[model samples]
Target: MASEILSTTDCETIVKNYLNRNDFEVMWYNLKPFFSEVNGFLGEHLLLLIDVKIKERTTTLRFFTKRFPFEHPMQSQYLNSMQGWQREIYFFETFLPNLERTLPGYSLDFVPRYLLGKPNDIIVFEDLTLRNFDLPRKPSLNLLDNQHICLAIKALAKYHAGSLAYEEYKSRELGKPYRLYSGEEELIKEPLIRKEEGFLGYDWFKAGVSGLRALINRVYKGEKPLEEVNAKFEILVEKALQLMFPHSNFRNVLAHGDLWAKNIMYQYEGDSSEPINVLLVDFQLQRYNVPIHDVLLFISLTTNRETKQKYFTFYLNYYYKEICNQLQSLNVSPEEVSMAYDEFLGSVTFIMPEIKIQGALQRLQQCGNKDFYTKLLGNKEEFIKFVFGDKTPFALELFDTDDNFRGLLTEAVEEVIESCLYPEIFREDCYRILEDTLGKSAYELKQYKTETIDEKEFLFKLEITVVIEKNEKEFKFLVQNKPLGFAKVIKKL
Candidate 1:
């Protein structure tokens, strides 16, 4: 075994944990262990390719295992400090079981069956490769393609729909709404938004930052680029961190939470480039949040520049339709599942900052994307300026040139404007309802959409007033806009 994370004894225990009592006898052999280069910091992913025999049947099994004991010191730090293993256990044992029961047989196959999982021990799963499933020929490039994006979206839709169905079921049958795996755990005391440590508090974010820094040093050898990238990254990272765990006012569903190329596998038919099946893996970061959180993360991290530009809206609508269909299958009403167009758009915009951060880091650490990055990053002269961060200076060219990068920024701005405008729309609808009830003489509501001095301020710059003169006395109401919600209503002469 090349990985020190799991020993021969650990392997034996994993096998024993999965075996049935009905088996007359069982034997395990050829415990060859290898590493998956694609994985990032849920500790080391040790894949054990072994041959197993039960009575007359002999079959080969591929077991995916994660153990901190044998991982590199830094990897161990990320895993232990973040408590990622416990999350995986809860996902496998608690979340999946509940979700599976809610899904019909047609959709249940999207998730790979796990053999066994335990805290502080190895988690084992059936290898999709044995079933002729494969990693994308070019994960970096393919993720940017329409085929892959659609496949991921469809699978995510099913997962989210199933979760929502389960939630509704619990509410009706159990007298309470169902909670997600994250809610089951008591450890998540602090919300990510309030954390002063920015996005660096979580182990995964720390690991990503470390990887990005390493990539910058490797590509451009100067302190200046490192400092520049870090400064820009810190701002984006903070925003990205918040988006990763959005406080969505809309309904929440179980997010895969760590959706990326390696965590999702696509199975194809007869050497076809198109995938017939998509399976989600690695639920260690699973959270209860907006379903769009997963959708945006998948699109941002995997889909290419042109694909994002062309199909981002199409993809969103397609997923919404799928959700509607899935919910109907579960007997949920269409009214309850009415598509939140604004919510999806806002989330897509929210995730724009993370697109570059995640994509750049994934590309840096990816094994097959060497030629891809080498082409996009630069020639010898440009490379020198990028590394040194001084002299002629090499700015990150991808943000300007890449279609996806520009699209993310554009969508982000649009989302911010919409976020500001939608409230006024909501208030208008509310006023109509109130006016119908009150039989008003005259009322006027005006809203201003003004950009602020501080770029991050999300509130609509507005001044609103309402006047009603009745019974020889005039009543006036006035209010100002605030991000947390409309400020307390004021009465004036």
Candidate 2:
């Protein structure tokens, strides 16, 4: 394994040496990025696939080399604070392989195996795609449904259970706690908490809340006024951030910090819609945090509104049961470690609003970086504003059009409203907003492909039939061919 990045020629040389087969000849090889622009922001992903010929037999081999700061901007403070590809290298090299001894029955082999590991802030792994692993269709645009969600949750439970077992094994054998990554205890500290004020002063936290407020105000005008609850918003966001970090009372398991739908892959059992296996890629954001951190983030960010409404409790129970079962499989009692439903719900409720805010921004970001930057206008001071620009299309535009984003936002919004946990003022305010907009109404959204009005705008129409006050309100109106980033009553009667 090279400590530093190798050039094209150097990569070929290392490949030859690593293969260590004189009888084989490398036929053709190429390197490509593993993540698309939407799924990836940091780190340079160089996936190399090579074909080799040995004794008139030709076979192909694949390896993935991920180099941080390869082409991405390493200047942003938020991006810099997230620097830890090497931690993942440590995970794959020293920690993951022990799953066989730790939990012999469970299959924790979903992750890609490493061909080379860290020395110079880079790690290489065997590509799993060659084994027929694939991302969900329209991964960036689609919401993960219940079946796939279950698979992902189970996979995460197994990984967490394995980590817990590994920790026990290390204590028994090494006579001390095992550190999977260097300075892991310190490195895994929550980024939202600053030295003095905690998440209250964190820029990302502030930006997320501010962006949510702006979007709400713009979309749900004259209802759900959040101007006065600014301080309350900050407080709630702080509470949620606190819930994310590990405490002494809870068992700290490894969390896949960025657990969105895009980072996970699945393989089906021969033309069946049900997925038989799941794999989690992208460990750059790995941290030692509560399992709920991964669980909440994944569910909140990935599931659609309908899924959450129908199966939120079911999914939580599912994950909790899986955790208990997996730990018990390793002879650990569930009561001792499993997070109770009440505690889990508390964390989920507190964090849902904040996560929804993030989910919106991330969806808007998926529209395109170029569009976002244009709205940004080189104004770092107004970054949050840029993130919610009207001109810029966001996932919200697809709300009435696409079921996935809509279900996700709807579930998030409804969960927060149902909790009644927000400050009375904020809760009442938002409640009124929902009642005025969607109350007593069953809205079925419809879409039609229309002509472009001009180069700057496209002319599209959304039709909705809402039942309210024992009356049906149906309306079709033209929207200026853009992603409606916020919920606005275009023609509500």
Candidate 3:
């Protein structure tokens, strides 16, 4: 019914514009819904398959059209608030054209060819599926094998390199440094970072943090209380928020902010299962950030633990090398355009904890059974409330029953603890055999009360009380500490 609004003449005009030929007459045309409802949350998609006749010749044309979700006012409002539609339109219209011109022979095979775009209304692209490019046969969690992962990484490398090259060209032409989010162009400004009044506001982020906190509290309840870990998690949240902004000291490039399996398509060799090419779609969340931001997200969301462990270093090396090669091809020095391998590794290690949290939340939503949650709670909002609110019993039950869910959540927690939180204490030689020797020790945070010791001086004392269970029975030891320490706070102006 929605497709009825576009007449045959309209379709003919679109096809004519794309082909740059007015002689072709429309013979047949059909528009159908494209992907699933979950795939395009902020927009509607239509697959347009048309047959055109030119003189005595007949040819088929396939196009994918994405339009604003006008039917869903709330979603439209959200998109407008975040400039999602505008950013995507800029990508297809201005950004791609400039990139192609800057690096004239460089390969943009990873990007789908943009056909036409109407600002905040619709964008049409050559349907990549017609060229044998398709989504991986399985869901994101299980879809990408090592080959797919490598290809995706390589594609990302090229994309980042291309953007950097374009920036260099624009800077030279303008006689000044040119950055995408230079605060001059509203359309290219950063969208989601520190934005507190939209769908992805602080409340949404807090909800995700609350959900993770609940899971941590539930999982490590008895002897292994996570007071220190929880404290670190709060700090990590702040750090993660800061990381969303671009670091001036680091190598910043245009990153596909949402690079997951669903956003990628692979063109396989004829008949064989080997993929020879990759195409990245969806630029709504594109932003200027460190290269590792995209790399960490893609690897974390798409691959399993074993795949990551086995090929993590190889993938990193491959991406770095590819991007360096891409830079070299574009006449830019890799040393100047890209971060060194050791620096890249440091960036990866530093940012991985927050990425783990992001991966956990995204994977949970992707892999979760929405119908089951909605049916259980009467609606999707209620289900979100259940997770974000104090409903740890249900969470614990889900954790116990669902292997995939449990694995994803626990992996995030374990990674944070092992990599980010109290690494010095945990990694020490003295604690090497503590877990094996003590079996498991549980502790509860009885009191974590803070008092202002000197209001004028901005000095505070934190008192922590813990109850630890020693033996198998209820042999609890109440350790009520005095003041843990005096923290001096400097008020920032």
Candidate 4:
């Protein structure tokens, strides 16, 4: 509803201070707040969908805002040029009360309860938009259902078993809150993806993911400084010695890190042949990395094993049978449940195109192959010799010669190489771990063979460098041409 900078007597004194001590009240004629506009990059996230009554226990109060981190300005310069997404709602209210006191079969079945915010920029909660939960106004991933694959494999083994029981029983009460492709939230998502660049919309093809990226500036002119991607993610937390729990526990736990089935939510138990009550709302990107990077970015960008291989082989055998029934409900054996499903199928990454966005795959080749998205967007003879700004003036007759838009331009470059989802299982294990550790100089890491998110492990114009020098006593590693352990470093100096 356009945008109302809070009011209705400040939404009736923030819904009468959470309904004056609680039997629930707020109804303001089915309150609504759903907008993907204001040139979108997510702002006005005071989370609402209100309509509550209680006493009759007609529950619903998902008034989330946990918001208090503002300093704004954005609508796209590529995408999310940050402004602390309410610091991921204060890292899901300081990691959901330590994941509801460590998973009793974890259940957050649909956001509708979490409120507290006001000191300018309000906060509220629980409002599943007054239910009757519809979904199919363009739903995909074969509209999942086997009780939404047993509540998304019981919410991905109760979120990697409450991040393996909060990093094996509370490590400094769980830390490392989301976003990390080398942090400061990738310098505020990179100046709003360069101010929403070639802009792509039309509900950007919903979670069926036809969206794209690769807008490039050598991925914004040679990145190797946020103090070297946080000193190579702080050298994968000092070569996995211990205590660094969330770099997405590839060995077990932590990695909701933004999985996409459009951040899932479902209820349909009665009408849809029962049992699809799986619910998960965005935990503002819970990171660490690899639970197969949220199961192949939520089964290759939202859903299609040609359109549901039984909700992707029943949520990949419901996380290899709930990490073998949580190591037989923690009696633990069978070699620690086959080493936690072989580190959960070596945290699956054949390439990495989860739900599409390399500048929405070169703006769909700058709108249907304007010559390979103007040669992966370096710009083709001034995007086909100057026509400027929003790129049209018959966008070169959309690649003419009597066009039909040439077979949807080879079906949008075979779905932008199936959204980089299989570039031959990440061209031999993430290009031999990025040229055996960030070698081949300071930029130029290929293997992006597309069809969609480079079938999972990705690369292109990857400029990286790590020149170290010690002397008489310790450190020593010289000469760079290419191929070496990409700075996953931690020198302590």
Candidate 5:
């Protein structure tokens, strides 16, 4: 294992090494960023696989990583996975390739290749250009249906099946216990509360950072409004970090610490009948977390009624069923899924209200750096506007991160399982309704050829199912060349 810390220049050198020789030619070098508001270690920047040329071969690749960042040196690293940070890394580095080789041909979907160089927290993987947005950072352009939700859940379960059996599948190759976040992040070298006031948010240039303008006066004085609330929010944030470790016992499983929709990929196959594959990207954030983080990230990030209503339950069931099927295929006794699920996510629901689904999604979609710069003088976007000609996109004053609705959804998923356990309870009418919505609204659905298996023929093809319009009342948004409405998912060949 070539495990030594790398610097920014080293990352560039390594990329050039790979590009100049066998597989690819360097086209564009993009710098990945981290969000200061969030965890420091969390990688917001990933190498965008632009063009590859090898052995008389040329190809194009694209996959996006949501720009999560770290603001100052004080930002603390945290975990959102069920198994926590430690397990997250373990699953990806250890479980991924091994599961593909072992386990009777069961597979998980994530970006194909990644680089583990130091310097600005770099991770590189397959570009899911075909797939739509992950729930968090979706530009309000794409729409998802029940099936889309289902496949996402299926992807989740398949992930669990591949990962849950880490020890049996390929434990020896599991280098360095790719578990919850333990490594130190250069950016976040300190804690939250102890940081200097100026580091809290950006200075109030246009309007300035909220919460703390006068540090000694307010922080020491115990400002009435924020003192109690800030204290509690900070505490919950820590709990959010701690929640990653579900059980100290079964610490071997792959967990996508940040499993929000932004990380999900959708290949629009133009056919509603075929099973649409949902692939994952961004692995630097991968760590040992409780399974619930995946579930929570997926459901909470993607289940905004804005995107699709009632998908909360739709996706949960999908994961459960897929997990069981994968186990059966691996001869691991399908029933063990419930036990695994139980192990990963029992006794932990309603931990804290999900930050409002939309608000969280917006945060997920944004780059931590822009969020960082905005805070410098306060108002990241406005700061950008101050710096440049175009103004940056800023959130509405009414944005809510309370997570009250998130809490509801979390409870609903865990409790609703009993009511909708049977397959019949899964709605056929729902699928029909989505098909109609998408079919009627599709201004033009273009099927794009996808090469699934590289050697022989195009493996999995996708159709660019871009819906031109939608019901404004249903899914509201401002699009450049489209109407308003919720987009549906159909797998028709």
Candidate 6:
């Protein structure tokens, strides 16, 4: 079936369309699988290395081809549900072209140049490897240096800024407001964060959370801080689902929802360790959300704790400044198009907990590679099922024995406790919510307690002394709390 899809005739058609001419003859061509099993989970990738002749000259061109892996019957249904093929087709054919036209003279080089696409099936891109852009040298694909981080942030900022510019351009041209996925079409209406079934659906997400909890429990067993964090897994899962979807309160941009190290390619100059250009790939999880969604995900997953502690503020400020520069280049005011630094920082703080949880889960999922799983579990299909089917024994085993995995998982829980749970901003937000709900000006948190109902549920009881005008009133409430703050006041006591 894949061969049929990329037959000689089909390849010629793709090439002709890309070159804008039918006069060329296909002299020679070769197709080789691209990426390893670890990186090729969603699609069947083929490097279409070809040589063609036209007007007495032979030209070589490399195109990266990706098609829905229908051959893997087990993953086909799941992949289809993700709508990656459809979304990527839309991005290459519709979204990028619009952006290119709108932001003329602005560099839209962060993404690979689109060549051709087949709706719901296959797409083609100019292979960036041929352009000297390659994945980071780190075997784990983590960006260790500040220069790499800076380049990534710059590219991301430009991409977000370009999306805003396109929206403004469309709004002016059509004499109305415009945004990505604003239309009622089925392709755009499909959500990546599906509650029922899909790659990032409730089932898969719960499985990840379950795996992380089991791993933490087994490895850290009676440790109090980790135990507390583990207790919040249920709440974190729900909170993550809520935070991942688009929120209306913040300034939104078309985010490359998956921005981890693997999806990014960098170009280097001579023998220098620093990169000159950063190119982003994989647009399947692209969504219209606040820019911080992508930024937080990238920083959390790609860098370790020390890098984050030393350079987190630097990265944030650099990204924000780049966004402003990009907006100004497009003749749009940064203040009008972007969130203020404080508000942006608040959004980051609000979403950090969910992001950390997601980073851990993503790493857990990545552990289900063919080499690792097959060697340990013997059956790849069964291993995959266990990884995504709300089973965790295999993942727990990996976490227990694998030093790198243990380190990453341990760090995630540590971050969740140190950076997410105990932050002053988090506490302030909790108190602020209580104040708003009770119509009080201020609240002194007298007692804050967490009750674990079962393995999958939690309740937060807050006893606060409310300052009503000049008087202090004591009250109790059963608060449905998220990591960000109190979700709601369930009842008053």
Best by lDDT: 6
Q: Is candidate 2 or candidate 6 better by lDDT?
A: 6
lDDT of 6 at 458: 35
For residues 173-250, write the lDDT of model 3, one tens digit per residue: 899887776656666555665636434444446666666677876656333347877887777777677777676656
- C-alpha TM-score for every candidate: 0.64, 0.67, 0.77, 0.28, 0.47, 0.79
Quantify all predictions' global Cα lDDT against the true fold: 0.53, 0.54, 0.66, 0.39, 0.39, 0.68
The 10 consecutive residues of candidate 1 with the worst lDDT sum are: 387-396
For candidate 2, the lDDT comes to 0.54
lDDT of 6 at 375: 63
Error of 1 at 458 (Å): 9.8
Q: Which stretches of candidate 4 lie over 4 Å from their true place?
A: 1-95, 98-100, 103-345, 350-423, 427-430, 437-493
Candidate 4, residues 364-433, lDDT tens digits: the string is 3323433444342354344322222233223334534424333333333333333333322332233333
- In model 1, which runs have C-alpha deviations exceeding 4 angstroms? 1-21, 35-40, 49-51, 56-60, 102-107, 139-143, 176-178, 181-248, 337-493
Model 1, 58-167: lDDT tens digits are 76657765544443444344455556677777767777776666555534666776766657656777767767676665635435467777787888888788877777
Task: Flag clash pairs in model 2.
Answer: 304-407, 305-407, 305-408, 397-484
Q: Which candidate should be chosen as best, given TM-score against the real structure?
A: 6
lDDT of each residue in 398-456, candidate 5, tens digit only: 12232432243333332222111211111222322334555442232211112232223
Error of 4 at 128 (Å): 25
Give the higher-lDDT candidate: 5 or 6: 6
Task: Provide backbone clash counts, one per model.
Answer: 10, 4, 4, 90, 70, 0
1 against 2, candidate with superior TM-score: 2
lDDT of 2 by residue, 1-493 (tens): 2323544454455466557656677677666776664224455667776777879998777777766554433223334564455556656665576667565575657686666654434567666666666776444534677778899899888888777776666666798755443344544655433424322225444444454444343343223445544444456555555555565545567777777776888887555656778889887667776676677667766755444444555676788788777888887665445355545444443344445444454543433335444545455444434432231234334444555445444444433332222221122122222345554223322111222334354333434344445666555444332221212223332
